[model samples]
Target: MSDHDPRPDASALPWSCEAEQSVLGALLVDNAAYDRAADLLRRQDFFDTRHGDIWDAISRLVLAMKPADVVTVFDALPEAKREEIGGLAYLGQLAACVPSAANLRRYAEIVRERAMQRALMQTADEALEVARGEGSFEEKSDRIGSLFATVRETGQRSKPLFVGDLMAQRVDHYNALAQGTVTPGISTGIPGLDEALGGGMWPGKVIVLAARPGVGKTSLAQQILLHGAEAGHTGLLLSQEMERTELVDRAVANLGSIGYSRLLNGKLSNPEWQRLGPAVDRLAALPFAIDDQAALTLHDIRTKAFAIKGLRLLAIDYVQLCAAPKGAPRNHTRNDVLTEISRGIKALAKDLGLTVLLLSQLNRDVEKRSSPEPTLADLRESGAIEQDADVIAFLWRVREYESHRLIACSLPKNRQAKPGAKLGLDFEGHYQRWRDSAEKVGHTGSVGGSADLGFN
Candidate 1:
């Protein structure tokens, strides 16, 4: 009792921030401190995974973001815990400081936008739950309305075409080309194919080279990859069915004037190795990247493509193997998935302004029919693929198993050129290469021999 006083103050001890919290605690001291803390954390640029996750969530909340589209974003917190978040309150306070719109019409428009988002999500949920079951006419009508509104809003926000911007972009293109910043799109060294492809692969187009199994689709694609890299353009090949080393083996076999099977089986002799070493070195040094990831989705491909700076071309081998994004409508058949994937690939070409080569599989109808040629209808999965692609090439090797190499390519749909034009060729199985046959006739484009391409 000697030291005890009737009135005691508890302010002597330092006030500790909340347990297991950083952002909230900062706001607890001063309601406006959350922004400074978030900004500081962002500037720090935490690279650790654990800290990254926390900071990402905090950063979103600091901006008063609605965590509705992504469900797992804020799923861990309870209502009480969210309420305890002083940072959220601070965000609310900051939001209040913004010039509150005096016009009710503008406010109503903003509210309507949020409502439309909710309505779209609701329609998506219903579509998923029903599993293509027929609903009442009224319910179906409402869902259609919601979908239409979402589509309209999205389309309206898309980039509008302008002549000024178009001209400026072209000027930038010529400038880049003059400065040696441009990379050749399709320098396959086959002058005929190169010319037909419009100075190599044109940007903002998807060219699908489709064939049946056991054909030379993969081989021809790999040839293009090496050629592109050697010509100073970055090329990414996503080979879902083959391994990375196997891809390298194909490239070396094609470039070094050797057999692919010989290289794979380690049957190359000292003399063969001597010839292969320089070719391999040159290929390894080229601006080429390969991902042998199996079962990749469209999104996975997009992520990898996005990393290539000044990317000239992206090739996806065999579309059917690639999966679509999860959580899509359950009623969406494989055709729907294919349509979405093709559209996505086309969008990538438009966004990156690079050529996209999408390898596709032909339907069994090609095998059943006596015509012995693949048509646009033979494209596996979706018709949308044919519609979306700027150029659709059908590859047909009359005798895939026969030793004499012959691969026939026909442009079924070329938006810029005459359609149904055949580009005939001979394939070299040992070197895994394609070339203009001595028998090539009526093709008016340029021509180059395989020997002239340094493949000897």
Candidate 2:
């Protein structure tokens, strides 16, 4: 192709030199435009090397609370690099080229679009390489998914809202609350827990449900998922430790009020069998799904979660069982991996605007103590779980038969309500369910302490 040809050569990559120039010029002409452009455009978004350098210099000056005019930006550039960007004269020309700063956002967007196109081209090349390599199908799929996730994240870049714009949304929310039309969050189906949470589990929150082994952490998580589904919310249960059939069996036991041992051993009476039919039917009708993928990485969970339409809540059976991303830092200890996993789950909750309830195992320290009640410090593997969680609840049950059925659900950390709130729950081991204890039941009372078998 000729040098002046309108058609691009096959080897030529996507770029927008003019758009990059206009963006930098706009910032220089009206320094206020830097705030708007900075959100949409990064230095690397510029196609030309010189333009990239100029944008980088402008960014440093603007971020330092200094003016980013042509003179200031030029002066900020290193002496060795000034000559490489066509000297100070080119900087002046760039500022003069833009007619007005009114279209700064548009120019920045164009630059960003070109950058994304270039990134996609690079990603395609990498995918081709992966396809040609000798890797497992799952490995290739994960690599491709990671690439797409990166691009999706890049496209979600947005400017910060003005206080006035935020105030408008706040006013609307206030009106909804006043009119009693607002559904603040998804309910856990337990009135006491719901009340303690101010309403229920909110979107974009990470809730850690932890306890010593055999304390019903998984059961509680399943209960929340089932209840959320019954409340007209779609939910996903990612069981890294349990089989799909096992989870279904637990659901059946909870729904039918049958003994779990009897259900497992096929020792149910005819009446119990009859109860199971309707319970299974009810579960099938609800919008709940389960995945029993072993050693699942965070990316796998995120990909599977995104495929479920209208998913409002996601429950991971246990956090420690989850595998870290492939090729994670070799120097990272087990605790570091767990910390990364916690942060990843937290980020996923915020990104998808859904609630993530993570079941976790408590450290042995809780059991060694006289009380045997778990705390935020007792979360296994990493303390990062406590920091990342919006709410941290510990399920404490005395192992004796008499007290085994009583679970003291304590909230050690609650971002939405007062912390250290404790709820007395009657644990029906046979039914695999929990009910709020009666008002007369003390926090440390046994399951039989309450005459009420239903939640408030």
Clashing pairs in 1: none
| Model 2: per-residue Cα lDDT over 1-456, one tens digit each | 012222254249887667877888888898877777877777667767678888899889888999988788989998988987877788888889888899988888888998898888888888888878987887787788788889878878656687998998999998997898886788898889898787899999998888876667788888889998988889999998879998898999898887787898999988898898899999999999999999888788889889999889999988989886766678978888888788888988988899999988887887666665666778888889999999998887632243336677888899978998887776777788877875322244222233322211
| Tens-place lDDT digits, model 1, residues 65-151 | 443112323343344444333324433432343332233223223333443444456566666665466776545544554454454
Candidate 1: 10-residue stretch with minimal lDDT: 1-10
- What pairs collide in candidate 2? none
**Top candidate (lDDT):** 2
- TM-scores for the candidates: 0.60, 0.81
